[model samples]
Every structure is written in C-alpha cells, then in structure tokens.
Target: MASGSIKKEANGTWMFVVDIKDETGKRKQKRRRGFKSRKEAQAELTKLLNDVNDGTYIEPVKTTLGEYMLTWLDSKHDNMSRLTIDSYRSYIKNHVAPSIGHVALSKLSPLDIQKLVTDLRSKKDHKGRSLSASTIQRIFNIVVTSLNNAKKMQLIKENVAKLIDKPKIKKKKIEVWDVDEIRVFLDGMYDNRHYICFHLALLTGMRQGEILGLSWKNIDYEKKLIHVTQTLSHDRKEINHGAKSHAGVRSISINEKDVAELKRHAHRIEEEKEKAGEELYEDRGLVVCTNIGRPVFADTIGKMFRKYYRKFNVTPIRFHDLRHTHASLLLKQGVHPKIVSERLGHSSVTITLDTYSHLLPNMQEEAASGLGNLIFSDPQKNEL
Candidate 1:
C-alpha cells in the first residue's frame, strides 16, 4: 500500500504526497508542494494523515484570497441592489484586497484575520484619521460572509473568520425634537416653499426618499391616505424603485389639514404649469418638485431645511431626525408600536420598539398605573 512520501522537487522546494481512497472508492493522490524544507513537508504529511483519519481532510485548491473574493463578488452581483453592490465593491477594493489578498484561501487562518483587523484599526492616514470601530467591524463582516459563502460552495473546508472575535462598536445616541420644538420650526417656515415637505415628513414619518418620490397619484383625497409604493434612489433618479421591503410598501392615513395643504400645493403647481406652458414644465408629476416640474434632489431639500433651521433658532437637528421625532412623539403618546412601524415603513414592529425602546419604560409605567386604576378601583376588587 502506498502511504506517503516527501521528496525534493527540481525547484529546490519539498513536495509531499499521500495516497488515499476518495469518497467514490477511487484511488487518488493528494499532493502539496512549496514547503521550504523536508522537515516541514514531513510534518504536513503527518497532519494530513491525522486529518484523513479524523474524516476532515479536504484537498486544498491553489487559489488566492483576492481571486476568490473577486469571484465571490461577481457571483453576488445579480442578487444585490445597485447601491449595495457598489458598497461591497468599495469595501473589497479599499480594505480587503489590499491586505490579505496574497494568502491562499484554504490556508487563511483565524490569526491572519485577527491581524488584519488589528492592522486596520491601528492604521491612520496623513490626516491622522483611523477607521472607526464600526467601519472596521463592517469590513470584517464582509470578509466573514465571503468566506462563509466559500465554505458553502466547498471551496474551503473551514471559515477562519468565524473563529475570530468581532470588533466592539459604540452605539451613537439618537437625537430627536419634542413637539414644542417641532412646532416652532414648522411655524417659522409656515409660508416657506418646502413647508409641505417638512409637514409630511414630521406627520407621516416617511423617509426622505419616500417624501421626495411621492406623486399626485399616490395620494387618496377621499380616503385621506398616502400610498408608499416606491422611493427615490440616492442619486436622484426620477423613476421610483420599490420600497426597501414588502413592509415598506404601505398606506398611511393623512390628516385632513395636511390633505388640504396638499390640494392647495397641487393647485399652485397647476397654475405654475399653465404660465410656463408644456415646454417649460418637465411634468414628472412629483408631489414635491422644482418650478418646472423636475424631480427635486435630496441635497437641495436638506440645504433648504438648513437655511430655515438657522432662521427658526430651534435645536439643531438634521431633516432626517424629523422622522425620528415623529416616531418618538407617537410612541410617547402611547400609540401602538405596530402602527408606528407601519407609518415609518420599518420592516417590523421589533425595529420600531428597539429604536424607541428608551421611551417604553415610561409608557410601561403608565400602562401599569392605568390597569391598576381600572381593576382595583373598588376595595373588593383589590382584595380579589
């Protein structure tokens, strides 16, 4: 029986080979080269035998980490969104491929992964800026997922990243405005051009894209509802893409006051259209658009809000925070979390709860007190 052998190759490297039966009962030889010495070759052979006995031996493939990562990204291109694919491409190019791309996929170890993360954390640019712990963790997670996919494809026998510890990330505190502050801001901009935009965002808790993507057809004047079917892409594309998820496609009831304002805005748009004529009116039919009816850019809206922000002299909060403020105010008033989740187009009530759980303790106490008052108002009921 042919067991194993170690010999010097013509290129001054030691090569080891082991004769074994594969899963199909066919005789095969597992050969590995590139060992610098006979001792290393013998030690590898011994370990190979142990692995074969333990039923964990896998034939290693000669593929570098960079090659596998590129292949992996190509494989996932169709499954991921445009923005997501772009982000993954950037992460791989900037962080992963530059570091451990030379290592063999099967030979990559937990130590190598740990060292890569440490290096990433310690590195600083000329401006003395290092990667944030969260960013480092995100890069590490991408590698972990890529390796996990490789394992699933049987490209590697094990995922080394799974054995490595993830970097710790500090969660930033969520800032929101109270109703009084919101009132001050809205009142300050009562006659401003983008007043309706701020009104819908604070009232409905819709995302910036959703608000910007709204069309006249999406609104139901009779039922007082706004259908959220799609949102604007980050690049300010006009055509609406489907909302983030199925849960994101929802209909939120609009208050009559906001509905009347929307009607007035629509009439104003129509007047502007008649004056400008069909030539000047681009006619994308967006609820919020430019003077000639082209889709409004998100940055433009943000800049407008910032200008009014200084005028209002209220607490400084990003326009996105208006959505959070809406959710927070509703949760404090004891609105059902499911309702809040639906209005905000969150994927689940759990997300809503987790995001606003800071306010839950007070709500819980109020709920308990109300229940006690309802059930224990009578002395006999209290005793029972």
Candidate 2:
C-alpha cells in the first residue's frame, strides 16, 4: 500500500484517498474512503502511512470481529484438524462473539479486552461453572490473534488486544515421587491390572494419551526408542501427530529393565493375537492398545492411574504431572537445558528454562558458591 491524502471539499465534507498497488505488480492502483470530519480523514491518512511502514497495513473495512473471524475460519478450515476447527469455532461462539461481537473492529481497545477477561472469570455458566484462568487465557489469546490479523489486513488501526493486560496464571508446583515413593507406587501398581500403563508413565514420562494412544508402528524395540506420533485426547479422540508444543515431539531412551518388561508384554500380546485367530489386530502394530487393538480411551488411562494411586498409598497427582516430574528430575540432576528442551518438545531452550528455572540446581549452586566466595573471601574481608 502507498500513501495519499485527505481532501476537504468546500461543502465541509472530508474525503480520504489511498494510492496502492493492485492485484498485478504494477503501479496502476487507487482507493477512496470518506469521513464526516477532517480529523477523521487525517487519522485515516496517518493509519495508512503507518501500515505501509510496518508492513502490516491492510485496507480499512467495515467488518466486525465476529464477522471477520467467521470469514477467516471459513477460509482456513481446510488447513486445520477437525478438533482444532471445532475448538476455534467454540471460542468464537462462546467467548469472542458474545462479548464484543457488536463492537466495531476499529474501536476495540485494550481496556475493553481486560474487562472482558475479568467478566469471564466472574460470569457463571448455565451450569454455574465459572471460567478457569487457563481457559480465559486461551480465549484471550484467540481473540487477540483475530484482531491482530484484522490490523495486519488494514481493517483496524491497531491491535489494541496486544496492548491489553493478559491475565496472570500461577504455575502449579510439580510433585515428583522420590525413589522410595516410586517403589511403593510400583508395588501397588502390580496388584492392579493396569500396571503396564503406570509402568510406562513413570518410566518414560510420556503423556497418558501418548501411552494409551501408542501404536506398535511408533515403537522401535530394537533401538529402545519410543516414537511419539499421536496423542490420546482427554475426550477419547485420537488426534494424529500434533503435540502440545514442538518440544513434545520427542524420542525417549528406555531402561533395559523396561525393555525386558515390554518384551514379555509383546510376547503375551503375540500369543493372544495368535489364539484370537490370525489377523484381528489391525497390523497397525500399537505398543499399547485396547481389546480389539485400537487406541485406548484417555479417561480409561486416568481411571487406571487413580486406581494405582489408591493401591500405592501416596499423594494423588494428575497424569500430566508425570511429564513435569520427569523434567523437574532432569533439571535437579543438572542436565543441560538444551537436552531437556529437546526431550520435552519445547520450541526452544528458553521455554524450558523459563518453565523449570526453579527446579534447576546448577545455576543455584553456582550463584550460591559465587556469593559465598565474594562475601567471605580474605580479599573481601580486608577491603570491607
């Protein structure tokens, strides 16, 4: 887009004109929009200049956030999964559209966004359930993102959503089981039939869905590596190959004992497969599966985890916390941040450090040791 001017007529009408390139990469192009006042026309001129400079300018449009989001979703639906499309749709219907759907795209502001989040938390659903902090944050991100695109497209002057104060979420303390506690948990798990699920959880730190959703094809017993290709969702749906973050896509090293146990389980499965008559197994070759060899439901895995907790006589924790335990353990052991980041499938080492900085012992040790030397050394004593 190129710059132009706001022309004022003798009749006291304001006219704004923007010169821009057309569909072809040629110089032949033009645009015309109007306002009731010279101030409005001047503001539009400034917006066009800034947009062209920022490389995010799109022509102004008379669309609402609700209307534009629906259009964007409709256009981009094919690029997303069934679950993701459904989720975005729900976000629009429930959060974005309901609150600020009537607000003009150009007029939405940061304060407005902050108020929306506050109201979401205080508002009660039909079931009397208040929105959680995390859920509100997710919705805020979506709404902001939609407005951000609107700004880039030149539909809005700016993304005031970016300027809004995002809600704060306190990170929960991760509970990691000590060796003795782990032993008790394992022993209690053996009494329950879902011991295999518990074994994979603590031993590998793989997610519940990853374990329940594991297929034989993703397992490389020869290499002793577990390839995480898909995750089992909390809703019992299997989403193929998408992880919570890029860092979540990882292959983990298993212990020899785990390898031996898996071998036994494999043989048992083989026997069952042979006895069940030839090809009942889809040959998809899942490492863990249900009776007919399809992926197990995520709820079933959670139930199994809870059962083992009761049997173990220990503090009950959510299954996802196991992954946190694994990362926390590695951090405590002074493992490099880069390695942990890769193992966890975090996008970068920065994320790993930010998330687990409290658990990291090496930096604390260095800082402590350095401070002691600086404070108590002979040179410092003499100087003081």
Candidate 3:
C-alpha cells in the first residue's frame, strides 16, 4: 500500500504520523514513510505516534541537499562577511553540487557520501596532486552540516550521514620557530620590503588576516602596542571583520623595534602617495597594506613567506606558523596558559592548555610535591 501519515481513499496507499522531538521537549507529529509491508508500516506508524506523544518524532519532508544548502547559504547573510560567502558559493558550485545534485533528499545514504569522499581522496586537481586530507574533510564537513540541518528542518526522516565512518584525520605536528630562529628571521626581514608584516607576525600571536587588516589607528607606537580587531581576505576584498575569537581582539605588545619598522614603512607609504600625486590608497590608517594603500591579501602574505624561504634557505612554513611560533615561544619562557590563550586569541584557557600541554614540563614534580604536603600536613580541625 502507498504509505503516508494522512488517510487516502485509494488502495496501496496510506497516511501515517511520526513523532519526533525538537531541541525543546515538545513532541510533534510528522507524516509519511513509504514501506511495502503493512505490519512494518503499522509498527512504524505506531512508533511515530508514540514518539509524538513522547515528544520525539522528527518530521519528514522531501527537500534535496541542494535545496537545503541553498537555503542555508541564504540564512548566512549576516553571519558571514560578503567575501567569505562568495568563496563559499564558488566552492559549493565547483566542487560539491556537480557530483551529488541528482541524489534524492530522502534517499541520500552514508554509502553515497563515503564513496564521494573516497573518490575525492584519490583524485588530483589543478594542483596536480590528490586533495589534502584537511581540504577533503572540510568539504565533507560542509556537506554533512548542510544535510544535518536538512534533517532538523524535517526535510529528511533520518540523518544517515552521521552514521558514515569518516576517515581518520591526522594532526600534523606543528613546526614552530625557536627564539634563535625568530631572531634570525627578523634580522633577515629588515632588508625586505614586507619587513613590517614579518616583524609583527613574529612578535604577536595575531593571525595573518588580523595583521594584514591592521590600521595605523589600531597601533599605539607611543604605548608600544597594536590592537588586533579584524582581518582581511584574498583579493584585498573588504568584509574582513571581527577577530577569529573574542580573545583575538586583544591588544598585542610591540617593542621599540616594531615601532621603528612601522615608522620607516609609514614614510615610504607617503613617498609612494606623493609619487602617484593623488590619494591612491584608502585613508584607513592601515599598518600594512598594498603599495597603492589597499588591504593586503592573506595568500599574498603566505607567498611572501615562501619567497623569504627561497631567499634565506629557511625551512618552508606558511605565514600562520608565525602565530604558532609566538605561542610556543611564550610557553617555553614559562608564560601561563591563560596568557598564551589571550595572546593567541583562543576562545578559552582550556584551548591553550590542550594545544600546548605536550610542550610544557612534566607534572611529576608537582604531583610528588602535592603528595608530600598532603601526607605530612596537620588538620586544623583535629587540633581544635
């Protein structure tokens, strides 16, 4: 019989209600599942009814992944900056929908997802290499998140995507620059045109985007600090807003050296403006920007780092490692985890400890000391 939650007058057809609970405790009725067995269908219907009574049955609708993703993208109107959403749309269009756009909403299965991921894992792109595990994982996560939201929207009966086994992602060991390494790097940067960018990155744990987004107004050379509040993206596109975390918005301490470098750079900027004989750059008071005074792209900074590596015979690392190096150096110098968290703009102190705990000294001494004190200490209450 055709099956559904509501009754139909035709044979081989039925209507039934399902019960699914929302995030709240309230139970709701969702209708329809097409099963061939009458007894099985009856059980399913009864279970759904019970769930509705118990506040557990999630509704079922028939919207495909493509449909849900489109809605999700629309909902991100304000949460995401304009530039980011543009890239997100591009990625989805070029990499995602082309493969699975035909899959039915209700018929989507883990096997289908697993095969998609596995295939991507093996194939190379324009880079002439198989996609990195991290990239593949990100794409997979976006798809799963979109599909999960679909389930929540009652467009699908079950979130089978959750059941799929995900490939184990390895956390590559972080390569941080030691104090000597930082000194060497900065010494070399003094002669480079992008020295200001490299110097601040080495000193403060601010992200690449944050450093690039920096405005001169954000810096207090007299106070020897730089306030990091935002970041820039690729293409010098506007919409680099808000720090990665609330803590990321904190002021970073600068030294006399950084102040001097910025001073020298500022003078050069005015020289370039005079050469152009017009207000070619934005008057945003940016600390580091393009030659013409637009915001710097994150990838451009990364490429700059690569150029330095080729020039200096240094080990190749992305611009981001500068932030990691800053945190690791702080921890090595016996700075507290909370301070590191604040410096790196981690959302919480726990995040700091988790990331750097392995690099800290062993807890054996503290544990032994605690044991000794507890064993020998007298109880004040007992004495009383």
lDDT of each: 0.85, 0.73, 0.73
Model 3 ranges off by over 4 Å: 1-60, 165-167, 279-282, 360-384
TM-scores of the candidates are: 0.85, 0.77, 0.78
Residue 37, model 3: lDDT of 56
Q: For residues 1-384, write the lDDT of model 1, one tens digit per residue.
A: 337999999999999988988879898988889999999999989988887777777778789887888788888867766777778888777777778878899889998898789779887756999988887998889898999998988888889998978888886667888778888988988777668899999999998989889889999999999999878777776455678788889999989898998988888888878988998898987898888888888999999888887887877789888999899999888788899998998888999988888855677788799999998799886789
Better of 1 and 3 by lDDT: 1
Best by TM-score: 1
Shift in Å, residue 181, candidate 2 = 1.8
Best by lDDT: 1
TM-score comparison, 1 vs 3, better candidate: 1
Clashes of 2: 11
Name the lDDT value of residue 40 in candidate 2: 84
lDDT of 2 by residue, 256-306 (tens): 878887777777677666766656664447666655556666777778777
Task: Write candidate 3's Cα lDDT for 213-299 as tens digits.
Answer: 888788888889888777876567663667876677788787887788889998888876667656565656677876777777777
